[model samples]
Target: MVRAFKNTLIIFSSLLFCFAQQEDSLKVGLQSLKKIESDVIIISAEVRSGNLNPTAYRFSVFPRHRPSEVYISRMFFPGDSLQVVLPENILDADSLANIASLEPVGGSFEKSYKLFSKQSDVIDLGIFDVKKKSDIVKLSVVDGQTGSPVLKPTIKIFQLGKVLYQTVLDSSGYGRLRIPIDRNREIPLYALIDTDGRYPLWRGSIEVSQGVSSITLALNSMSLMIGESLFRVRSDLTPFRKGPENGSEILFMLSKDDHIVISRSAGNKLYGRVRLDLHTKKSSNFFHGWIRTKDVEYLETFATDTNHD
Candidate 1:
C-alpha cells in the first residue's frame, strides 16, 4: 500500500509540471505575436461634406515608394471614420510623408492630405471637409472686342496656383463649376480659357461671391499692327536677349505658352514683345526683346492693307 501511494503522488507531480511548461510556452508565443503587431501603424480620419451623399465618395492611401500598391477602404458614411493599416517602416528616408486621397466616384475632384510621423501606433486625422457639387456658379465666356461667345472653349479654374476645376464649355460658351467658398464670403480665383489656338491664352482673376449665380469672362482678341505677327514660345525658360547676337545680355526669360508679337527678323533672331499681363491695361507691362527664331513657332500673320504706302 505504501509503494502504490508514492507512485500516485509522483504521477500527479509530473502532470503539474507538464501543465506549467505548456502555460509558459503559450505566454511566450502570445508575447511574440504582440511584438509583431506593434510594428504596424493605424491611421484614422473622419470625412464630411454637408448635404452631399457620402456613399458617392471613397478613401485611398498611396504608399510613397509603391504607389501602385494602394490601400482602399470600404464605402463609409458621413459620420464614420476611415481606417487604414500600414507598416511602420513604410516611409523611406527621401519621403516626408505618405499621401491620402479622398475622391468621389467618376470624378476628378480629389482632395489629398499628408500623413506625417507619429510616436503612437495609432494616428487620428481630424475631420476633413469636402466641397459639395451644389455650390456651383454658371460661367459665360465671350470675346472682349467682338462681344461674341467663344464656342466650345476649354476652361480651367485655379486657386492658389493649383487647378481646382476643369471643363469644356458647350456650344453656347456656358458652363458651371463648383467654387469653394471660405469664411470671408469671397474667393479670388483665376480662369484660363483656351480656344484651340484661335486666340491668345486668356488668363484673368475674378472675385467670386457666395451669393452670385453667374459670371462672364471677357477674353481679349489677338490684335497686332500691320508688320506684327504672332508666335508662341516653344520651350520653357527660353532666353530673351537685348540684341540679336548670341553674346548679347539676357534681358529676361520666357516660358512655354507665352505669346510674342514679332515685328522683324535678323539672321536667326526675331524682335518680339511679350505682354506681362494680358488682362492689365498698363503700357509699362510690355517687354520687348530679341528671341532666337528656333525658340518660337509662328502662329499667324497680321498684315493689313494699312501696311501699303
Candidate 2:
C-alpha cells in the first residue's frame, strides 16, 4: 500500500510539471507575437471639405513588395488621429519604396504614401489642396455653341482611373485643379463636366505637363430646336431677361402656365421661345428671351410616348 501511494504521488507531480511547462511556453509565444507581428503607426486623416464631415471612412495600406497583402484598416472619421498596427513585413527595407494609401476618404480616392520613409510613425492626411505651383491645372468652362461662360457646372479630373480633383465652377466659370506632373504623359489626364447628369455630360482630356496649363470646355446648347415645348411651373409671373442674370434687361413677362420651347443656355439660364397663352387651341404668338433656372421648372423627358395620352 505504501508503494502504491508513492506511485500515485509521482504521477501527480509529472502532470503538474507538464502543465507548468505549457503555461511558460504560452507566455513566451504571446510575447513574441506582441513584439514582432505588427508595426505600430499613427495616421491622421482630414476631409477634403474643411467644414463638412465625411460619411463613412476606411484606409488601406499597400506594401510595394507584397502587393497581394493589402492591409485594410478599421473605421476612421474625418480629422481622425489614431494609432494602428500594420503588418511587420511592411518594415522590410526592400518593401519600403512604394507603399501607398488607397481611398483615404473611404470612397473612390487613391493616394500613395511611402510608409517606410516616414521617420516618425505619424501620417497626416490633410485636405487635398495644391501643394506645389507645378501641380496647378487651370480649367475654363464655356458654352459650346455660343462661346459664353458656363457657370456652376461640376468638374471632376481623373488620372489613371483615380480622381485627382473635383469642384464646381465658380461665378467665373473656372476651377483650379491640382494634379501631379506627368512626365511620361503615358497616363492621360481626363476631365468630366456636369457629373450629376443634370445636363449633358461633357468630357475632355489633355497630356499633362509641369506648370500651369489651361483647357477650355464647351457645353452644348440647351435651347429647344423646334416643336418641343416645356410648361412653366412658377406660381407667379416670371420675367424674361435679355441676358441670363436677373439684373439684365427684362425682355418680356411669362405666366405660370405658359408653354415654352428652350433654344439655348447662358450659364444656368435657359433661352427659349414661349407662347402667350397655354390654353389656346389656335397657334399663339411666341416671344424669345432667357430665364433663370431658379425661377422655373422643366421636365426631364428622356423617352416619351407621343400617343400615350
Candidate 3:
C-alpha cells in the first residue's frame, strides 16, 4: 500500500508540472500577438451635410485614373463617422483625400466629387435636388467618324450635380427626355452618352425653356485617328507621358487591360489618345499624350515591319 501511494503521488506531480508549462507558453503567445497588433493604427473620419444624413452614402477614395480604390464601409452612423486605415504610404505616394460618394441621387449619377479632409476628420458633402420640369428635349446619337447610329447608347440627364434621369437610346440612335425648367427662365442641363459603358462617347449641355427642343450628337471614338494600329497596355499602372523620351512628364495612368489606338510615333515615343468616362460612367473626357515604345507591348506590328528572330 505504501508503494502504490508513492506511485500515484508521482503521477499527479508530473501532470501538474506539464499543466504549468502549457499555461506559461499560452501566456507568452498572447503577449506576442498583443505587441504585433499595437503597430496597426486606424483613423476616424466623418461625413456631414446639412440636408441629408451623409452616413447613408458610400465613399470611394482613389487617384484620378487608377482603378484600385479604397471603399469606406457603412458601419458608422448617428455621428456619420467611419474608420480609415490606409495602406502604408498610400496617402503620400498617391492621392487619397479625393472622396467620391457613390450615392446616386434619385438613382442616376455616380460621379466622384473632390472633398478635402480637414484636421478635424470631417468631410463636408453638399446635397442636391432636381428642379421643376419644363422642356421636352430630343436628341440623336451617332458615330462622329462614320455617322453611323450608335445602338443602345446610354444617356444621363443631369442638372446641378443631380442626375434626373438615365435612359438607353433606341435603335435609331435617338432619345428624348424632359428637363426641369421654369418658363421664361433658362436652366442649363447636361447629357452624357456612352456605348455600353465601354467608352465615353459624348458630353454636352443644353439650355431649356417651356418648349420642345431637338439636337444631334456625334459620338467620339475610344480610339484616336481610326484606321491606325491598336494596342493594349502591357502592364497595369502604366504612365502616359507628355513626350517620347525618358523622364518625360506623366500625363496620366492607364490600366493594363485598357485599349489604346496609336495615332503617330515621334522618336521613341508613340502619341496616343483615350476617352475616359470617369467614375460616373457618364461624362467622358479626352486625353492625348506620349507613351514609350518599351512601355507598351505590341498587339500588332506596323505594316512597314521587318521580320527579326
Candidate 4:
C-alpha cells in the first residue's frame, strides 16, 4: 500500500509540473499574440552576456521594412516587467542570424487577414480543394553574406493550422510549392521555415484578387542550416499545402517502426542530424527520414540496461 501511494504521488507531481510549464508557456504566447498588429513583423531574441554593457540581451522589432521606424519588443523575465530588450548588438545579430542559431520571435499578419481561399489562416487538409493547383510560390534560401545557395534544410507546408507536408530543401534552398486557389481565396498567403516557427526569410502575399490568371512568387535569399543534410527522399505526399497529414491511418497502423534516420550522437545524447536517411516504401516515393526521438529514447533505455549488466 505504501509503495502504491508513493507511485501515485510521483505521478501527481509530474502532472502538476507539466501543467505549470504549459501555463507559463501560454502566458508567453499571449504576450507575443498582443504585439503583432501589422502586415509584416520581424523579431529576434538574442542572448548577450558579453562586453556589451548597456543591454545584455535585446530583440529587434520590425513593424515594416522601412528600417527607420523600429519597435523593440519587451522580454518578460518572470518577476520583471515586460522590458524592451532590443539593443544594438542584438539587432546586429539578427541581421546575421544563422538558421540554427537564431531563435526568432515574430509573426506576420494575425488570424484576421486571410491568406488563402476564403478560409482561416491555418493549415488543415480537409477544407482545401485537393486537386486545385494554380499558383506556385518558390523560395530559395541561400548564404546571407555570400550570394550562394543554401543546400539543405527542412521545410514544411501548413494549411489552416495543421502540417500537411514537409521535405528537406534542395541544393538551391528551394522548396517548390503549389497551393490551390479559388476566387474566394484572400491575400497574405504565408510561407514559413518550420525550424522554430519563423516567417519566411523571403515572402509572397496577395490581397485575394479576382483579376489574376496565375501567380508566381519568388522568395528572397536567406541562410538556413549550413550543414543540414540533403538525403534522397520520396513521399506520396509532397509539400503541397492541400494534402492530408497521414493519408490512410487504417490502410496501415500508425506505428513508429517505419521511421529511420542516420543521426549523429554526442555523448549518448542526440541533438539532431546533419546526415539523415531516406526510405522508399511500397508503391510510394523515397522520402527523407526524421531523427526518431522515440528510437533515441529507446536506445537510452537500452544503454541503461547495458550499464546495469
Q: Which lDDT values do the candidates have, in the order given?
A: 0.72, 0.59, 0.60, 0.34
Give a tens-digit lDDT track for model 1, residues 195-288. 8666667777765655448888776555677788788888789999998889999988887767888889999899978876533522226788
lDDT tens readout by residue for model 4, 1-309: 999999999999999999999999999888777554322223222233222122211223332223455444343332232223232232322332211111112321111111212112221212111122234556566544465665565655555544444567776666655444442354234444432212122222332233233322322222224332212112322221111232312222112212222234334222332211123111222222233222322222112211111
The 10 consecutive residues of candidate 4 with the worst lDDT sum are 109-118
Give the lDDT of residue 5 in candidate 3. 100
Q: Where is model 4 more than 4 Å wrong at Cα?
A: 1-131, 163-165, 195-309
After best superposition, candidate 2 residue 69: deviation in angstroms?
Answer: 5.8
Candidate with the greatest lDDT versus the true structure: 1
Per-residue C-alpha lDDT of model 2 across residues 1-309, encoded as one tens digit per residue: 999999999999999999999999999999988876445555454445443234545555555777677665566665564335654444444534435453445333334343544434565644442122236667788765578787778878787778777888887788787675533356677777772323345555755556677767666523454444453536456788787777999977665534455656778888877544233212235677888777766655521213211
Q: List candidate 1 segments past 4 Å from native.
A: 1-131, 182-187, 247-251, 278-285, 300-309
Which is the winner by TM-score between candidate 3 and candidate 4? 3
Q: Which 10 consecutive residues of model 2 have the lowest summed lDDT?
A: 300-309
TM-score of each: 0.50, 0.35, 0.38, 0.22
Error of 2 at 173 (Å): 24
lDDT for model 4: 0.34
